[model samples]
Structures are given as structure tokens and as C-alpha cells.
Target: MDRLILADTERREIKALLNVSMDIDLNETKDFELSVHRSAWDDTYQYGGYIFKPGTEIGGRIGRLNTDTALETVKVCGLTWRGMLNRKVIEPPAGQDYRRISGELHEVMKELIEPEFEGLFLVSEADTGVTVKNHKFERYTDLLSGIIKMLKSVKYKLRITYQEESQRAGYVLVEAVPIIDYSSQIELSSDSGLDFQLNDIRNGYNHMIVAGKGELAERNVFHLYAWPDGSIRKTPYYTGIDERVYVYENTSTETEEVEEKAREEFAELMNRQEFTMNTSDLQMEVGIGDILGGRDYLTGVYMAKPVENIIYTTDAYGTMNVEYQLEGED
Candidate 1:
């Protein structure tokens, strides 16, 4: 008979089959709206590098390994936005006029929810406010909230781009991978009345044990729960531990004292052998009967796998491709 052995090659093949692949595109649009706006915002919030002015002088060496020389510095202009709204019709008394203007500005601000409006504001000339004419401003708070909820429910490889066509018109492209949510459940218990608990632990757990009929050989069993989002909650259950016996043969031990000494020695040898056998026989089996057969004397083990690589590439036109691979096991 051939002995069974777990091969590294087999394990590697199983791991490859279980791995996940993800692709994300950072930019996939003609209009680079989001990119431009993000860049502008970043540049304003974080200081951009200083510029040098023509004909200005500074005391320093500008060339490589040269003596001190004169240099010039120039400051970049800050970009900002301010808005003014004129009320076309306001039937109000003296103090109420301020409230009316506030109302009008609030309505005008609602138009900013449009992508074109945001893009225009990001790229428009400083201090130039784009005005809406003959347009009734409708609130988009619900729409915005719904969009955010939808985005969070799925996994996505996101791509963003920005484009500006004048001071008042532009668009952004947002391409994303479809999102998916999956879940699984597992239960752990034992027949020998041993208690178990798997609650409050965000990571899943695994259980291993040894069981079978007979004194010389026993079968190993294993159970695993691999859930990404939440931990498994389990109540304590009873599974009894099994004890084994070993018999030892002794020669030239006819005396009572010799027999007693031999019995003690034999017991120690049996204990060591059982420990070795249990360690070597650990196995993970999945089936209704297997799970029920060895519920007691089980030990829990938890393991995690991580993503290994993520790569992104872009061409001359700024189109991007992204690839990601997660390391895993079978």
C-alpha cells in the first residue's frame, strides 16, 4: 500500500485556483474633470513649489558645484471662488431684504451639484462666478445620498478623468468595476459535552481534532470558516476528549517489583506515541458525516491571506490599466 503525503506542489496549485484578481483603471475618459479638480484642490491646499521671476536676484549658487550667485523668486497667484446672486423678484420690507438675498444665494448654490457646474467652478478664471439664468434650483440632497449608498454596496475598480471646455462647461468620467457582497456561516460543537465559543472575533475560526475506533490508529478532522466582513459567533457545546491505552511487553520481569516498574515505563511510552500520532494525523475534512462524527476534542485555528501585488499602467493619451492579485490558499 502507498502512504498518503501532502505535497507542496499540490498546495501551490490549490492556492492559485483560490486566488482573486482585481483590475482598476484610474483614468478612462476624454474629459479629465475629476483629475483636474483634484489636482487644483491639492495644489491649493498643499503648497505648490515656488517659481523664479525674470531679472530678480537671490544670493546663492544656481549651477552645480559653483560659487554663490544671484537668484530671483516669484509667487504664484491663489485661485478662489466668490458668488453673487441678484433677486429678480423680491416682495419684502426693509429688514426682510437681507433674508431674501440669503434665500436667493442658497437656491443658486443648489445648482453646484451638477458635474458640469463643479467642473466649471474648478477650472473657471479666478473670481469669476458662473451664473444660472431662468433656472429653478432643485435640491439634490436625496440624490447625492442615494449615490453614495450605491457606491459603497459594491466593489469597484475606479477610474476618474476631468475635462474643461470653457469657463462654464466641463465633465468627468467615472468608470468603476461592479461590486459584490458574499457571506457564509459555519457551526462548531462537540459530542463529549465540551464547550466552545467563537463570538466577538471578527476573523473566522478553524477546528481540528482526532477521532476513530480502535486503540492503534485514529482519523484527523478539520473545519474552517473564512468570512471577510464579520466574525463568527458560536456558543459553547460539549465534545468529549478521547483517551487511548497502550500495552507494553516486558522480558525478564517475573518479580512483583520488576512488573510494577515495567508498567510505569509502558504507560510513559504509550503517552508519547499517542501525542506523535495525533500531531501527524491532523486533517481538514468537509462533509455532513465528517462534521458530525468528531465534534468533540476539537481545537480552533485561524489563518488569513493577503493580497500580494497591484500594478497600474498608462499610455501616451493617459488611458490607464490596473491589475491586482491576492495571495491565497486552497
Candidate 2:
């Protein structure tokens, strides 16, 4: 496996782009308020005096006013408010406390900012004779929209693996080599005129299509993977090669030959096969409450690459292992 190293600046740029891709801007009018309260009080203490008695040390009680001292109290009450657009709140610095009125405004802003990722694709197994349709057709924008929707819903982290093939001495065999993993996030626009919702998140599993281009003709299929908590590592694995990977039902040897021929033809025409995969494990993650009101919340997205799967002409095969390490900031 070949590992790709990203500079800190590059990582930051990628993160920004991912955030933009995942956040949805909304215009729905909604708001809430948070009320804050505060109070103050004073206390006194006794001290030893300099003077000493004939038989004992002396002590004195001081009656000094606690000037510039103030008691502070805070309470937040949520209130319903209205607006024409959704807005984000600029939180105060950590040390500063919010006043009752500001707290209410902050609450309103919090409610106004919208949640991200709202799209769904439904898929099921069909009979071999059923006609397949490409929903977006020729319009690239429409295609992009549909693809983005599918990707956002699935939270897919893309990996692009490339291989070079050679046919020598009348024998045909292909060598597959793993390539770079493309890390990305899908984002949708509320103004895109596309109607989607988060209902599917609560409704269990969903499906989506995976299209490929260039040198990928042998793999073409709709692969649906769900990651409820958006954990890419747990995303479903599918290569969209159902026919290649399985025995067709009720098919004779002749029929199998015909299918193979058709697959080869299709692969040739497309110039690249598109395949997809799904996973049930992608959606598991830590809950919101687990991170809220905590000293620090750390979450990571994990990915693994196979470094070596080599076959030598001497009929020898070997594997390679690679480890990752992080260095501290300079």
C-alpha cells in the first residue's frame, strides 16, 4: 500500500472544503431565546493583632466593607422568536459571561442555524430482466446533484485504485494495484431546488448510486452504504460486481457465457466500469451528549490501505505492512 502524506495547510484546506460541502444554508424563519441571571454578597474574617496581653496573645475582629465585591448569578430561559432567515451565532469568548438578553439572542441564533446532509436513495434487488434506468441522464449538473445527494447521505470517503494490465504470450491476466484514497465529504445546498430530508436517518437504511469514469469500465453498479455517525471506516464495502462475484440464478452454462460476453462488451463501451459497495457499520458513532459540556471531545475518522500483495514470476507471494505516526507542531 502506498501512503499519501498531506501537509498541515493542505489538511486545513481540505477540512474547510469538507465543512462547506456538508453545511446547508437555510432561510426558514425560526429562533429561540436564552435568559441569564446573576447575584452578589459579602463575607468577613478575623485576624491576629500586633498587641500582646500580659498573659496571652491578642486577636482582633475586623469590620471592613468588601468594596468592589459583587455577587454573580446566571440562569438561562429559552424563548421562541421569529426571523426571515437562519443565522449563526458568534459566541462570546470563554471567560466572558452572557447577559440575560444576549443569552436569549444566542439561543435564537443556535436554533436558526440548520443541520446538514438531507438526501435519500432507495434501492432493492430486481429480477435479471428488469430494465435499469439512469435517473439524471445527460445533464452533468443534474448528475452532479444526484451524485452529491447520494454521497452526502452515505458519507462516503472516496478511494481511487488504479492498475495497469498487460497481455503476454496469448495468456490474459490482469494485475491490480492499490492507489490513493481520496478523502472528501458531500454537501447539499438548500437553494438547489432539490427536495430532501433527514427523515431517512431515523428510518434505518438507504441506498445510492456510484458512477465511474475512465479505466473503470469493468465495475458499474449502485452501491448503498450507510454511516449513521458518518464513520467512513465502518462504511459498507461493495465493488458493485454482483454478477462477477456471484452465481446467477437459474442460468445455464450457455446463458453464463452470454452474460460474460455482454459484460465484456459493456466494459469496452463504457471505457471504465463503475462499481459500488455498501456497509451497515458506517453509521455507528458517539452521541451528541457524549461530547457536549465536556472538557475535551476527541473524535477521529480512520482508514486503512493494503500496502502489498505481490506475486512474483517464481510463484512467490509476499505482503508488506506500514504504520502511521503523527509529529507535534513545530
Candidate closest to the true structure, highest TM-score: 1
Q: What is the per-residue lDDT of model 1 for residues 157-185, given as tens digits with 9 covering 90 to 100?
A: 22223332344322332323232211122
Cα lDDT tens digits, model 2, 78-133, are: 11111111122323336643211122211322222222101101111222221212
Backbone clash total, candidate 2: 30
Q: Give the residue spans of candidate 1 off by over 4 A.
A: 1-117, 120-159, 163-169, 175-177, 180-330
lDDT (Cα) of model 2 = 0.20
TM-score of every candidate: 0.20, 0.13
